[model samples]
Target: MSEKQAKKERTRKRLTQEEKAKIKQVEETHRLEARALRENWLNLDNAALIYPAIGSTEWNSVFRLSAIISEKVNCDLLEQALRDTLKRYPFFNVSLCDGLFWHYFQTLSTAPKVELETNYPCRPFTFNRKNQIFRVLYLDNKISFETFHSLTDGGGAMRFFNTLLARYFELTGVKYKNLGDFDLNVRDLPVEEESEDAFHRFANNGKCKPRKETTAYAIKGALENPNILNVVLGSVNIDALKECAKTYGATVNEFLSAVYLSVMIAEKHHSNTKNRHPVKLSVPVSLRRFYPTKTMRNFSQYLNYEVPTDRENASFSELIEIIKAQSKNINIDYFQQMFNANIRSERNFFVRILPLAVKDPILKFVYNRVGERLFTSTLSNLGICKLPAELDDKILNYHFILGATKLNRINLTAVTFKDKCCLTFSTRLSERRVIREFFKMLTSFNLNVEIISNV
Candidate 1:
């Protein structure tokens, strides 16, 4: 053999040793925790307790978050990356299971399948042993992750998604130069607190406050196909949105919420419905800011904001202040009350002793009757996502999509990356008035809004 071939052989062996050394580093740190987690069964996190009871196979509680990369996805490399990445996020390597009284997550000793992206995003997932609660999908230049709400919320899922992207880039022989907001070294291990139930940890046993009772008006529209979730996506300049919000002395989320409420109010008037019920917006607030913990589970509380029925005719500026006032009432003390109420109900002796068969129906009934009744629409702003400079060149943009619900058919979500903010509307309804007016309103403010894509 030539001397050049011998040199190449030695370099390949050295690279293999380096990879093994990195694997050993992670195993040394995570061996004990990973072993225990796989052997144990854990109760659903506080915010997730109702999902199993409420979800169905046809429309299970799931949300999709997709990132559009500049390059096409390589299936073989993605599959290999998933295997290595799961080692860092072993908690996500679990499946849904049932207990005598409640549904739980049981760690799996096996790997999950990665699939091609479906035409419809946020496709239903099963809550049984047959399938994992989350899936990784790729199509063309896009990579989408659909997860069971019971598994994690947007924040947690975003971190996992970002890590997976970073790993995928690494596997493609990209230089490990900048990791900006991600801490995804190949040897990083899961921290213990990342798996804890934060709501229980932060619960204060105060008096449980009774939630306000008011039925919000609903949107009626022509339904799409059962297998389809209609998605409308728009991109706006982050600076332009920020400036527009500043004119009203509001944050970007507050301004968007007000716009959403304003549109619904207009829709109500246009429909000529005399119900005159309060049109409320359910705005989800991430609890990570108020707390010190960083658990990769559902840890958010939503604030229900509405224009008072008496003030229904109030102008757009007034709605902005109204949302701001409602937002101000949200802080540690407010979340504590929510935790108290939720835990108080969960800890009741009757609730605890009930069988799963008996409790499931009741939970679903409460959700449909009380929970869905309170909000006309839902909006979750996952704030801006930032990746390393290198990744910025490879990843074009990010978007968040909330799956449609029965009552809240037209829901909104926005995610920003760098200078672009993508606003996505997910609904089963074919009617486009509210969605059309939403963009029209943003453009009315002299903001440049463009349609990104639709599904």
Candidate 2:
């Protein structure tokens, strides 16, 4: 009787095991197929490819803050907080994988490689160490949050920073009630889609004539400690600035670009170079305008605006007109061509698998040379931030630091926060008089402006 009962029970358990195994196998098959499709689509768009040559592209963003707080914020706490936060919000927790022929592939076990070297050209892309590519560095007076650009733009970063800081204060026992109100629940945030429409389009109609002559300027100064002066200039009402742009038939971006070009031209003239070649400034346009996708990967593209160097007598009004004309000419077809061309260039299998050992050196050489000759400076304008209007109460100010690109010389980043636009200029040049003069001129126009210098 005992033997018969035991055999019956064993058979029942065996059937249950078989059913579970079948279900598990089906789920695995679905996941593998989904991953393959993602890889293939990324390959077609050329969005999944990584530039092995660039050091900054590999490492996550790094921040160095002044050490003032008495309590120490350790990595363990940061890691635990991040894990809990990610569990609540899965989108920020995802990473990319390399597949053969851009099809379904196996997940790699190791963390996506993040190259961190002091000499690397670009600013560190933030990596999520706990979740593949996202990472946060907390130094005694400095905190840097770096992420894969595909996850979020500056606006997204700002939101993350605010939340992280609130969490830090709560952990440190700071008497901040707002910290409790902060929603660390990732479930509340909307998941971003990876779509073609997420990028800004350009005109691509203008002629690309060869420059008459190219000049190189070697940046001089300490790469680390360039005198960093942060000036809090007077605020400009967002509405007034918009109206000003309308009056000039230019968007807020075009107007800011013109202001930057004017400053650069003034500096070039001060150098007294006889060659009157046009000065080119690279303007990084947020792709969010053209496409609706907001996932934080390198979704931004750039356009170049050439300002006549010989315009010593050109009034600010005239310069605005030139910028308006150039900016208006940018449209969707122009960007599609660029998007298509970049995809073709990376189609070579060798380019995708090139060993970093060989690629990095070649990239360094090419980047250094191009940095000296191609563009005078980079002008990045992160348009007016549209945050939940309620944040206007406690949020004091917002600012952005320019990334350390291939060129260690100089770069300008402008972000409009609240009602004011903050323009930050980073350079290795010893003479910051040009930047000062630029601010002074703005003041002369009765645009309440302030200057902060690292010099």
Candidate 3:
């Protein structure tokens, strides 16, 4: 046959038995993968539903969790650790997709990648990316894990990071015993409890009247470069901070909240204003503490604390007392009320049936207009992180930071490990006044704080 005719004959050749078998095998693999993906998919929970509805490039709800180790990060080992870690958390490696009526998560077949840390924490997440919801980054001695808020709260993120770190150490030939839930020997399976939608499990239909919230006096300053967030991380002695809290008859969170309120009040003092408007602050209370749920999703509520500055000369002591009292009222009933208010709204006959394409705009409007204006700033303390005694010495410290929102320029987050407490102030505005006063107040209380700022 001529060369052209031979080529045409080859192209028209039918498949052999081996070729047919290979094709069938490939098709079978794909079918299995598709089935697994479908089985792993989950609808967004009650608390998580709002995040995708309102998240934007400028105001995404994302946060960062970091672990500082004694030695520099081993990227190769870390990557392997990530792959192994992700196998156990099928839910973590998910890509979010929009449905006609809601947003849901689909488990990804691709593995999570670890890269050298270069950018700031809490970059926007586009579902189209290879890894949708979270990124693992390493720089020198620090390994940082940043995730979309809808994926998990700080508590959940911390557990994931701790496990990742422990697994990384294991890969690096570090002998550590009792690796907790991160032991690779554990079977790679999703815990039913960990992936549950706890809010739905605990929510009640009991209607709590929505309380009126006044627009807070916003902290004004020259806006920083559009997307850049200024971070000021202060490492304080945990014992000293606890001692200071004890002196004031408050917990560390309560004391810190008081300190933040005082700093806001001090801003007015520095500006020489006698205006007595209340300084409002919001503190996120984890629902896991109230309800017994192992879900690693967003299961937290906020306690909005307002110190009535209308009282002439509201002292720090007075603010602490007011904060303490408000905190006492944040029991199970309070969270149930908060959950009911949210779930009830979502359960509205019209809301549940509305198409997402149409519902997103309305939700965004409500979040921006009503919710965003309620609190001037937020403080989320993940509290003390515990690890096995064997692994504790190799790890140095931990830090948590809440990304800023459009109306709320500044937000604070704290997590303690070992003897050190890492308190991070993340701000979008180009003003250092709030953080500066915050650290100064801690120092004035005789708690020495080593301050570092990301310019």
In candidate 2 the C-alpha lDDT for residue 304 amounts to 74
Which candidate, 1 or 3, has the higher lDDT?
1
RMSD of 2: 8.6
Off by over 4 Å in 3: 1-26, 38-40, 181-188, 209-211, 269-277
Pairwise TM-score winner, candidates 1 and 2: 1
Q: What is the C-alpha lDDT of each candidate?
A: 0.87, 0.52, 0.83
At residue 332, give the lDDT of candidate 3. 82
TM-scores for candidates 1 onward, in order: 0.90, 0.64, 0.92
Q: Compose the digit string of candidate 3's lDDT tens values, residues 1-455.
A: 99999988786577787887998999999999888876777888888998888887666888999888999998999998888778777788888888888888888888877878777777777775255699999999999999988899888888788878877887878775655444333234668889888988888778664757776756767888766888999999999999999998999999999999888877766766544456789998888877888888889988888877574267888889989898888788878887888888888999989999999999999888888688878998898898877777789888887877768889999999989999999988887989988998899999899987778
By TM-score: ranked, best first: 3, 1, 2
Per-residue CA lDDT of model 2 for 1-455, tens digit only, reads: 69999999887677777787997899999898767634432321333233323434433222221111334455555555555455433444454433443311122223322223223122454332233444555544334456544445554555565555444544544444343344433334445343232332222334333333364332334444422322223345556667766777788777767776777777766777665567777886666567655444456566777765555458878988777777777875556566555544454577557654554466557655653366677777666654333445434444455544445356777767677777766554556655677567656555666554434
lDDT of 3 at 405: 74
Best by lDDT: 1
